[model samples]
Target: MAFSATARDSAVAEMNITPLVDVMLVLLVIFMVSAPLLTKTVDAALPQIVPPSLDTIKPLQMQLDVGDDGSYRLDGRLLTQSEVGERLAEAAISDPRAVLRVHASSGADYQQVVTALAEARNRGIANLSVQH
Candidate 1:
């Protein structure tokens, strides 16, 4: 049956929101009651250890200097690009504890410095430092 378009009859065509409100209220109460039970805590008594200092012990380190003239040096001795990777790999293999410090000149190419850093990493140097 079609409802008349009169204003009084048009009220029947509107939605009844009472059931929706009741469901929302029920969900809110359920969440409020269960919220506390969802959280859990555990007591932990863990021991702490102090880390070693960098300035304390100075080990024998290997230095790689990249000059603005595109030259490489391993401990002040000049080397070509091809020799850098091979020599660094050997040094890393000989003493894994050896730290490799890269000193790039101010005018040195950014890509060259990055490439040298990558070469050290690729050679499996564990401790690498850069001096810009």
Candidate 2:
């Protein structure tokens, strides 16, 4: 077979990279324009956060004790049955999250302990415990 010199001259073997260069230049311009916009900031006022007070941070705790002689004591202070109820109600109002722990003596009358517990429950004492 005879080779034709004209056919070889007409054929182009080089890779075309014009579209690739055009895309890279467009991407460079886009990134350059967006880089400054990314660093731009707007001035605005942010709300200040107030630290929590001691009262809210610490839970309120109270202890009630029933003596064997049918007497009630709150925080080591002797109080009447009606006064116990009043104190519990005040505590509930002062801090609804207050915790009450009832401690009964070994010989304490069951009825007295029950009465105290019932009063505490009625006063909205959600956190309560009875100890013997």
Each model's C-alpha lDDT? 0.87, 0.93
How well is each residue in 1-132 modelled by candidate 1, as lDDT tens digits?
A: 765579766787799999999999999999999999889677899987656785466655899999998888889999887799999888888877779999999999988898998988898787989998
Q: Model 1: clashing residue pairs?
A: none
Over 4 Å off in model 1, which ranges?
1-60
Best by TM-score: 2
Could you tell me every candidate's TM-score relative to the true structure?
Answer: 0.55, 0.58
Tens-digit per-residue lDDT, 1-132, candidate 2: 998987886676567899999999999999999999999899999997776685368668999999999999999999999999999999999989889999999999999999999999998888998999
Top candidate when judged by lDDT against the true structure: 2
Per-residue lDDT, model 2, residue 35, is: 100
What clash count goes with each model? 0, 0
Relative to the true structure, candidate 2 has a C-alpha RMSD (angstroms) of: 5.8
Worst 10 residues of 1 by lDDT: 51-60
In model 2, the runs with Cα more than 4 Å from the true position are 1-56
